[model samples]
Structures are given as C-alpha cells and as structure tokens.
Target: MAGAFEEETNLYNRIVLGSLLPEGAWEPLPHWLQGWLRNYIGGTLVYFISSFLWCFYIYYLKRNRYIPKDAIPTNKAMLLQIAVAMKAMPFYVVLPAISEYMVEQGWTKCFASIDDVGWPTYFRNLALYLTIVEFGIYWMHRELHDIKPLYKYLHATHHIYNKQNTLSPFAGLAFHPLDGIMQALPHVMALFLVRMHFRTHIALLFIEGIWTANIHDCIHGKLWPVMGAGYHTIHHTTYRHNYGHYTIWMDWMFGTLRDPEEDEAKKM
Candidate 1:
C-alpha cells in the first residue's frame, strides 16, 4: 500500500508540478508550499482562463441570442455579476486543489494517461462521474429550496437574475461563496466514487464551465435528453421547476419539470 501510494504521489507531482510550472520554478519551494502552489494556483489558473473565454464568447461574439436584446441585463447589472464572481473565485480555486490532493492520496482514482485506461473504460468513468455530480446537485438544489433558511441565506443570490437576458456565463459562478461550494461539492465527491483519468477530470471541469454558461444564455431548446438553456431559464423565472443541472431525469422523476412552451399554450 505504501509503495502504491508513493508511486501515485510521484505521478501526480510530475503531472501537476512538472507540466504546469516552469522548469525549476517549483524546486525551491518547501514540500507543503509546493503542493499548495500546484493545486491552488493551477486550479485557479484553469478556471480563470475557461471563465474568461466563455464570457467573452457569450457577451461579444454570440450576438444573436435567445433572449431579446432589450431584455438583457444592463451593463451595470452585468458588471455587478462579474464582481460577485470575482469575489467567489477563491472557493472555486480551493475545491479543485483539495480534490487533486485527494486524488494523490489515493482517496480518489487517477490515471496518468487515457491510453492506460483504454477508451471504453475512460468513457464509462466519465459517464459515471457526470451522473454522480448531477444526482448530488439535484438533491442538494431541491433541499436548498425546501429549507427556507438555506434558500434565504445561500441560494438566493443566484436567483437575483430571474429573467432571460439578465444572465450571462459570468452569472454561472456568480453564486455566493457557500452556494458555489455546495454546487461544486458533487464534482469533488465523484472523484472518490469513481476511478478516472486525470485528463477526464480536466475535461469534465472544462465542459462544465462552458455548459454552465450555455444553460444561462436564455436559449430555448433541449440538447435532446440533456437539459439546455431553455430548461434552466424557466427555473430562473419560476423558481419552482427544472432544478437539475445537466439532466431533466431527476426533475422528471420528482415531478418538478415544467415545460415552458406547454405552460404558455395552456395560458392562451
């Protein structure tokens, strides 16, 4: 067990410190400090780059959008959302770092290469991870709503933008620090539950960052079985339905899924 632990530790050190840092840049740091720098700084850097790109794409390039132009949040509101996101960045950074350390310690599975695991195993693990995360967040989200105090203190900040165009990709992480952490708890938990390649972990996080923004773009359409911006938009507007993050299965199962189009037709 000790030998296996040492091998995994060495592998993580090489992948995280070796690849992410300049040659010799990490050598001078104390052992504890090396871990801190690699996990915290590296995690923050990845999230920052992903967040910036997604925000830029949505606000600048994706001009013709689902929400009408006039209904979009004003520049001031968007700026406030960005500011809140910045304040909440530390939670985002620290969680991934903690997860990485867990992986290194063998509390979670980690592979050095996708080839090591084979393509079929890699895909299965990815699916399993997503399911775990979605299941966790769905229940936690519903609990946040059911518990009045939790909703009032934690989840309310995210609901501030209750309209379509008022949300952007930036709004995705603009949650209160506690709320942000809660939403992300599933990702961390999934690491412990499933064996995954390091590359798969990174890919899942990257896709999640982009998907969070896409779901808030106010576009009305499902990504087939996967819930899309339209499904989430209704959640923002109604605050009573469509609570699952990536899939409609939970909401459908629990009877919280509301179809906006169908509701509109009934009103007419």
Candidate 2:
C-alpha cells in the first residue's frame, strides 16, 4: 500500500510538471511549495520579466538603429505597445481566462499538465504542439504579406526596422490586434487538442512571449547567444521574404534565407 501511494504521488508530481525539471536533478518539493511557485510566481514572473526586458531592448534598439554598420534599427512606438501587452494582456486577458478555463474543466492542471508522461516523451509531444504553433504563425505572417490591401494596415509596422532589433519585432504587435491574437491562437488550440499539462501550458505561453521578444533583438538576429536568426532581419531589410518568427527552417524552405546580392547593394 505504501509503495502504491508513492507511485501515485510521483505520478501527480510528474504530470503537474512536464518540462520544467530536467532529467534527474532534485527530488520533487512539497505540494504546497509547488503550488505556490507554479500558481503565484511562475506565470507572473515570466510575463513581467519578458515584458520589461522587451522594453529595455526596444529602447536600446531605438538608440542604435540609425547606425550604418551591420546593425538594425528599432521602432519607438512599437516598444511601448510591447510594454502594454505585458500589463493589458496577462492581467486583463490571458491569465484570468486560462485560470477560469482550468477550473471549469476541473483539470486542476494549471496550463499544460502532463499527467502520465516522463521527460523525453513529454517534450516529444510538446514538440509536435510547438510545431503546430509555429506553422500557424508562419502562415499568418505570410498572409499579412501576400495579401495587398491588408499589408499596410497589418504588416507594415514591423517593417519600420530597416535592419532588425529585438525591440522592433514586438513593436509591430501594436500594428493590428489580429496579429497578436493570431500569434497566440495556435498555442491555445494546441492545448485543447493535447490536453497539455497545466504548468507546461503556462511555460509554453511564457516561452512564446519571450521567444518573440528575443528574436526581435537588434543584434545580428541570433535568438539566443547561439541558434540561427537574422532571417527576420532579412525580411525587414528586403521587405519581401523570410517571415518565420522562431526558427529559420521555414524561411529556408521557402527560399528566403537572405540575398547575397541585395546584402551587397544595401552595403553599397
């Protein structure tokens, strides 16, 4: 009976936390602490930190965008909108609704609870969902450009950055409400489709918030210190192609991985 109880307890902890813990680190903390961290701190912290960093980066991008080096420009107005999303979005819209939805479903799972899966398996499933989410954003971004009349109203704001800055990418969020919502819609759909583990759901959302903000960094477009980026900058530079927000695979697939000829002309 004791061993059975232990297994059940371990299962609960695992499902409540899908991807937060790495493989074989610390043992699980107590339930009360887990609840506090997951419910109170994690969600708010991710949003706030991502939002503030976004503001600062945008500010930095603004000061530097005008230079002629390999650098890009940032948009001031777009920065403010990113700031607004931090407050208006998490407080007014997303968190409250997600909380309520969880209660209604009686899932007790916070965001994307993984009730039965372990580490590799959970991430494997999550990869599928994340891919789906990325595809949605890719297509939506494509529509904004491919369609003419909508371009001026929906997509032009992001193009304000001639080069690329962390700030200018999010600055485009204020462009059109549809743009922000469209970016988020995929995650929401993925959660429903897979019954994501609650906390994982929240973590993924936080990732999206930070992921979008980071790619827009005015630097050479590396999402992190590593990884491929700059493609978004290519989009801003040419104002024609390379629209994926996260990874460049889609851009490469579509034949938009920066033009050598155009890069030279812009330099000239």
Candidate 3:
C-alpha cells in the first residue's frame, strides 16, 4: 500500500506540479510538503465544483420545488460564502495533509492494505474508526454551540448564514479557518484511536465537502440515519438542535434531535 501511495503521489507531482514548477523541483521536496500541495489543489477543486454543481441543480433547476424563490440567497450572498470558504480552504486542507504524513511515518494506526489485517479485522477496525469519528464530531459540533465563547469566536462565521434565505451550498464551507478545522479534527484524531485504511481515511475527508454541500442546500432527502439538509436547516435557524455530523443518531441519543417533520407540523 505504501508503495502504491508513493507511486501515485510521485506521478501526480510529476504530471501536475512538474508543469508549473521548475523541472525536478517537486521531486526533491519532502514527502509531507508534496502531500500538502496535492491536498490543497484537490481540495480546492472539489469544494468549488461540488458547491457549484449542487447550487446550480437545487437553486436553479429545482428552485420552485425545494425553496421559495424569494427565499433564495442572492448571487452576492453565495459569492461571499464562496469567498470566505476559499480563504479558509488552504488551512482546512492542512489537517488531512498532516494526517497523511503521520500515516506515512507509521505514527497512526493506518494500515497499508486490507491484507495486512485480513478482511475480518479490517471490517472491525473500520467500524471502530467510524464510531470514533462520529462520536467525536458530534461532541465537537455540539460544544461549538453549547460553549458561548467558542460560538462567539469560531462558529459564528458559519452561523451567519442562519436562514433559508442566507444558506446555500456555498455556505457549507464558509466557516472561519479554525472553525472548519475544529469540526474536521475528529477525522484526523480517529487515526490514533483505531486502525483505518489509509486510502479510505483520505477518501472520507474529501467526502465531507460533498456532504456539507448536501446538508446546506435546504432540500430534505429524508434518508433515515442520514443528517440531511432538512435537519441541518433547523440547526441554522434555532441554533440549539440537530448537531450531529453525518447522521442524526448522536443528536437523538443525546436529546438534541429535532425532526424536520416536527417543524412542519407547527406551521399547520
């Protein structure tokens, strides 16, 4: 697995960075720096592309169905969300890059391949990894609101888009740099807690960009266990419920879950 990772990264550096940097310069740089560069480029591209695609589909194509036309955020609002997110992105990518470096150095419980631990143990470790990450993220997110100082300083940047009219796919990553890292820190921390596939961990971190965009689109997927945009929009408005990350189980277990349907019933 290490060999495959090294080979893939080397090829990426040569093909991508080589075109821009002086010939051979990218090869001589340390491994961690190379990973960070790759992460920054890939992360930025995913953020922009995913956010734009989701926004185009929901805000334009399905606007009449999902949200009232008057409730849509203005073009300027979306651009501001994009601007804040872009500024914070360089910092946000650092966490995963550092995690990759740790895995390469054998500092974390990241396995090189599934064969190294066999299928049974690999699946077991995979379960543990997800549990740790989900639990950690739930608490981290909840505390960001529970603790007044943290909210005032860090989480407030995100809460600015606390309305259907203000929230959009672009608002998903429009957080203070540190705020974004704090929320994502669980993914990095889980590496030390349980064994995980090096590639899978990296893939999950990128998946977060897509997930966030989905939850901020103000369209309910109604997928049980999944924390869809319906639940998240309630969090934006009320600021006191539905603090779970990928799923609502954490909020449900902790007594903070607020069903979107409950909100609907109140209107009647």
Candidate 4:
C-alpha cells in the first residue's frame, strides 16, 4: 500500500509540473472537441433542470402569494417569463472552459492521487478558478451592457424578469438564442488556452454552479440581505451599471459596480 501511494504521489507531481500524467490520467482528444462536449453537456443539463424548476417555482410563488398580479407578466410576457427561466444553462456552458484555457497557458496544472482530493487543494483551486472565471465573465458581461448592438440583439431578452425574486434568474433565458451561444465564448477561449484534466474541470463547474444560480435564483431585494439580487437587479432594471458577474471583489476592482448606499449616504 505504501509503495502504491508513493507511486501515485510521484505521478501527481509529474503531472502538475508539465510532465504527462500517467497513462491512466491522460488522454488525447483535441481540446476543442473535448470543450465542445463539455459545453454541450453543461448547457444541456442546466437548461433542463433550471427551466422546469424555475417555471414551477414561479408558478408556486404566483399561486401562493400575491405580488400584486398587476405587476405579474402579461400573457405575451408570460412566454418570455418562462423562457428566461433557462438562465442556468449559460453558466454551465461557460465555466468548465477556464480549466481548458489555464492549462494551455501553463498557469494551472492538475494533480491526481490523494493530494488533489484534499480540502486545502480544493479551496486553493476553487479560489484560483473563481478568480479566473469572474475576470473573464466580468469583462464579457460588461461589454454586453456597454456595447450597443450586442446588448440590443442578444441580451434584451433577459430584461423581461426585472420583476424581482427567485424567478429573476429566469430572465437570462429570454435572451436571444444567439445570446446563449455568445455566453460560451469565454469558455471556448478558456478551453483553447487551458489544459486541465476532467477532475479539475468538474470542480470548477461545481463552484460556478452555485454562484451563477444565486445571481438570479436568490439575488433580489437589497444588498444588505446578504447576497441579495439588488446589484444584479440594478443591472437588469437600469442596465447602466453593476456589470460584475458574481464576486463583490471583481465589481470593486473594475469600478463598474453600483453602490446605492454610498450615494444615498452622501445625500444624507
């Protein structure tokens, strides 16, 4: 057992430092093809589950409570409303991609064996992947807001859900079908540039899964409610600012984020 363990550790080290992973850990598919598969599967699952569940959730909310049905979607708007429920798909499709890119640039490496499964390595990689994903998404999303034609053609669909609440993430699905494809652009770039093994790719995906869902599923109301949708709501309602994708840190870094508190306090 000890000898077997040592062999695995040595193999992990070699793989992390640009050496080919042991035969069991590596494969030869073209990165683009691999990424294509990754994107398809990711996009498919997110759409399937999120769309069904969100619509159901929206139905439940509408049925149970009263948000002044006057503000509820019109019949025509209802179609759009349900459509936006598919927002989770883009997140699934876009995130595995960074692993592909970071590996290509040699900025990231994968390890197999025991160390890769440990908590420390998990968190470390989580931070690294999140930072990379946020950076790519932040700029791309900012462009979606700041750029004129693309926003009009591609992103306007998600604006339908400005109503607020758990269903808000559904707004993303109303996006032009092309908008879905465009969201994958970052992942495509990441896959082409990075060269991660499948395990790392899965880990990154898991991290992003929760964050993206929170953007719409849970991020509503005010900023003070701890990760409310207020910031993202401003993005959709006004479409002027707060283009950061997830982390407060990135929004702060880019100066694109809107902070109503600061402005309001100044007025006081």
Best by lDDT: 3
lDDT of each: 0.74, 0.53, 0.87, 0.51
Local lDDT at 92 for model 3: 95
TM-score of each: 0.81, 0.60, 0.93, 0.58
As a whole number from 0 to 100, the lDDT of residue 31 in candidate 1 is 49
Per-candidate clashes come to 0, 18, 0, 15
Q: State the lDDT at 144 in candidate 2.
A: 78
Span of ten consecutive residues with least summed lDDT in model 2: 221-230
lDDT of 1 at 244: 93
Shift of residue 133 alpha carbon in model 3, Å: 0.9
For model 3, residues 192-228, the per-residue Cα lDDT tens digits are: 9888888788889999998898899888889998999
Error of 3 at 72 (Å): 1.5
lDDT digits (tens) for residues 1-268 of candidate 4: 3343334433433444224234534235444444534454555556446644754565465453533344333445545554554454444444445444444444544433435456765666556655676677777777776788987877766664654442333444445556644554554455333333335555445444334444654224454533345566566666767666555566777676676565347779
In candidate 4 the C-alpha lDDT for residue 264 amounts to 46
- The alpha-carbon deviation from the true structure for residue 22 of candidate 1, after best TM-score superposition, in angstroms, is 8.7
Tell me the tens digit of each residue's lDDT in model 2 across 1-268: 2233234434544654544656543246654344433433444455557645765654555544532333433345555656644433433234424543443355442232344567666777677776776777777778878888667875665455555433344543343545555556666666555544555654566576566655555445434412233555566666677677666566667775564345657899
Cα deviation in Å at residue 84, candidate 1? 0.5
